[model samples]
Target: MSEQALTLKQSGIRWLWLAVVIFVADIAIKFVVMENMGYGWSNRIEVLPFFNLLYVHNYGAAFSFLSDQSGWQRWFFTAIAFAVTGMLSYWMSKLPAKEKWNNIAYAMIIGGAVGNVFDRVVHGFVVDYLDFYWGTYHWPAFNLADTTICIGAAMIIIDSFRSEKKSD
Candidate 1:
């Protein structure tokens, strides 16, 4: 293979390591929460005025959408996660090695997707904790995978604007 081709391939593989790290961390943290924390909201352990370690099982999409449905949502979301991961992998492979921000974003997304998919496949739901609240209101509980996905999405948005500004 050409030197350029070899370099690109190596770069792609290196970027994928970030995904693997995120996936492992997400799974490990979830496992710890599962082992130490009790299930349901009644067992929340307050770590701060605005934060708590809580356990929640989300059977549907973000914010528990369709969680009330029969049960098809589990497989549906799982399939979606797999599809997204595949697409991100392909997209990352196509990106230039110098596009660090884009690659990082893709890696985070792929990792997070895999993490959630694993949970859905094994537990029939996404295991969530890391609760944040304010006064009488509480944000929907989310795990590291969810946080990584959101951060990745935000990074992508920021990179898009930066790219646009550079072109202008």
Candidate 2:
């Protein structure tokens, strides 16, 4: 039997589906959070000793960078997220289907980026709910999108190292 060539749409499409799933889940959870929790620091529910569900609007990037700015950061971050999502989509499309790690990483990044972008466009800030802390020290609250993006980034880093090791 002869080997058949797969078209772009037939290849690496599963990764795109994963991206869609992530996007949907992210949006849905955010909606639930918005519906149940009050805006800002009003309605906080402690879920665990080191975790809480709190509503926070971040008008800036990670760790609320530039969050104190005069509101220009909203559009700026929205634009950046859109651009990154676009780039990651393009990159994912170009990858071979067998490159599972890279595909998954790109899809996750794209999904997370789009999720945050939607928040910025709709609410003028990203909605963050998950809060983790230990004693008096608290990690900045973040959402599923942020968590997925960090996981994807870490996977990409690991993939790079694996590739380098293989090449050696």
Candidate 3:
């Protein structure tokens, strides 16, 4: 660990609290969904004309990719999530705490990744809710963790553009 990392407030790792918050909230919400809702398409509760609360388990990554595979994907995704969380946490620890944008973004991603990983380990699948649809077409159901991950990834991309502008 570097000198900066030794100083608790000085390191961007301070933002890890946000990650913990996100992780806890994600897990609690998943629990709520599981306990309250019956599984599958038939049990979905329409929240709005275009939205629904649907509890489903995703055995694969986003959009249920490779969800049909014979069970290996759960471990694969869990491993990848932990690797990513580790890398991001390391980066956060090295960065100055003043680097709010990237730190927050990384924290969000780390939180989401860990949340999903927990699901894979405990339930053998990621529990998904929140369905959005338009007419007969429907977008994939996802949860708060996915939302945070996507938002964090977008923030990182946006940060790249800012860095480029500053350099140029």
Candidate 4:
């Protein structure tokens, strides 16, 4: 029997739907948070022993890096998101449909990045609401987009350990 060749799904762009879903869900939740919740730490709603719904904004990247800058970081991060999303989409188009892990990971990153870009463009900052804490200390606030990106990044890292022969 001959070795079967992999078909990368109409160039694998099909996987991008997962990205779109993430973008839509993130934006929709942000909209809900903005419409129903008051902003700032004083307005946070305690949801559980370790979590709260806190509406806030991040003007910079992960962990609020550069959040204190005047204003240039907004466009800078937006530009980076555009470039990275484009690159990931391109990679998805070239990857095999059978490579579900990598394709889905790329789609997730694309979705999450685009969602954050939308926030940066429309609101001048990313909307963060989910807050976790340990007694007096708290993890930096984040949103669904941040969650998706982190999960996607982890998927890619896990994929890295797989034998490359699986792809070929």
Scored by TM-score, the top model is 3
Candidate 1 yields a Cα-based lDDT of: 0.89
Candidates arranged by TM-score, highest first:
3, 1, 2, 4
Model 1, 33-81: lDDT tens digits are 9999899999999999999998889988788999999999999988888
lDDT of 3 by residue, 1-168 (tens): 876447867988899999999999999999999999999999999999999999999999999999999999999989999999999999998888999999999999999999999999999999999899999999999999999999999999999999999999
Q: How many residue pairs clash in each candidate?
A: 0, 0, 0, 0
Error of 1 at 95 (Å): 1.3
lDDT of 4 by residue, 10-100 (tens): 5557788899999999999999999999999999999999999989999999999999999999999999999999899878877776678
Worst 10 residues of 1 by lDDT: 5-14
- Candidates arranged by lDDT, highest first: 3, 4, 1, 2
lDDT of each: 0.89, 0.87, 0.94, 0.90
Candidate 1 stretches with Cα past 4 Å from truth are 1-8
lDDT for each residue of candidate 2 in 50-149, tens digit (9 for 90 to 100): 9999888988888999999999998888888888888887787677778889899988988898899999889889999999999989899899999999
The global Cα lDDT (0 to 1) of model 2 is 0.87
TM-score of each: 0.93, 0.92, 0.96, 0.91
Candidate 2: stretches off by over 4 Å: 1-6
Cα RMSD of all models vs. native, in order, equals 1.8, 2.9, 1.8, 4.6
